[model samples]
Target: MSKTISFVLNGRQRSVQVDDPEMPLLYALRNDLGLHGPRFGCGLAQCGACTVHVEGKAVRSCTFPVAQAAGAKLLTLEGLGTPERPHALQKAFIEEQAVQCGYCI
Candidate 1:
């Protein structure tokens, strides 16, 4: 059965229909919401590539259940800032030349 999961994404209200509530939140964010900020690194959640903020805490979206994120606030990299005005961390990274492959930023 398809279940509707609602959450605050990037300061906007959003909802997605998930067949399995246990499905990873990353799939909903990436495939359903069309967000490319989070990447699937290690499915084991050892890597922090799929890290996203939920309820003001960092979480590995790869293993996080979409159901658990219902009615919660989610913040992805895209929510940080725009190209015209980058976030402080993003600006610092560019100034310090910390960006490399841009995979695990």
Candidate 2:
């Protein structure tokens, strides 16, 4: 059964139809919404790669259920900043050359 899940993504209101309410939030964010900031490091949630902020708390979207994210505020890497106006951390990373493979960055 497909269900409509709504939430605040990157400071914008967004919604997606999920075939499984229990589907991982990562799928909804990446596949459904076309947001690729979060990567699929490990589906077991052991890795911090798929981490995203949910209601101001860090969550592993790979294991986080879409139903639980409904109506919550989500923040991914893309939400941090843009190329023209990068976030403070993003600017610092560039200046310091902290990013390597761009997986967790």
Candidate 3:
């Protein structure tokens, strides 16, 4: 059975129905909420592509259980900034042209 998991997503309070509490937060963010910022790299969490900010700290969403995020705040790449006012790192990356495929951007 699916259970509702409530959390703050990019500063907005949101809830998602998770069938398995052990389900990765990546799935909830992508399949459920339709977010594309976090890439699905190595499903084993060995790669850094599935990184997301949880309560201001980086966490591997691919292997992170959705239940563990209840009531916590989450931030994805898209939440980092906007085109009009990109984040410092974002601006630096653009200036340096240090991005390709954007899997870990």
The per-model lDDT (C-alpha) reads 0.95, 0.92, 0.92
Q: Point out the higher-scoring one by lDDT: 1 or 3.
A: 1
- For candidate 1, report its TM-score: 0.93
TM of each candidate vs. truth: 0.93, 0.92, 0.91
| lDDT (C-alpha) at residue 16 in model 2 | 94
Query: Candidate 3 has which clashing residue pairs, if any?
Result: none
- Give the least accurate 10-residue stretch of model 3, judged by summed lDDT: 96-105
**Reference-based lDDT, residue 99, model 1:** 52
Please list the residue runs of candidate 2 whose C-alpha ends up more than 4 Å from where it truly belongs after superposition: 101-105
lDDT of 2 by residue, 5-104 (tens): 9999999999999889999999999998998789899799997899999999999999999999999999999999989999999999999989577656
Sort every candidate by lDDT, greatest first. Answer: 1, 2, 3
lDDT score for residue 54 of model 2: 99
Number of the predicted model whose TM-score against the real structure is largest: 1
Q: Write the per-residue lDDT of candidate 3 for residues 14-46, one digit (tens) a residue.
A: 999977999999999999999988989889888
In candidate 2, which residue pairs clash? none
Which scores better on TM-score, 1 or 2?
1
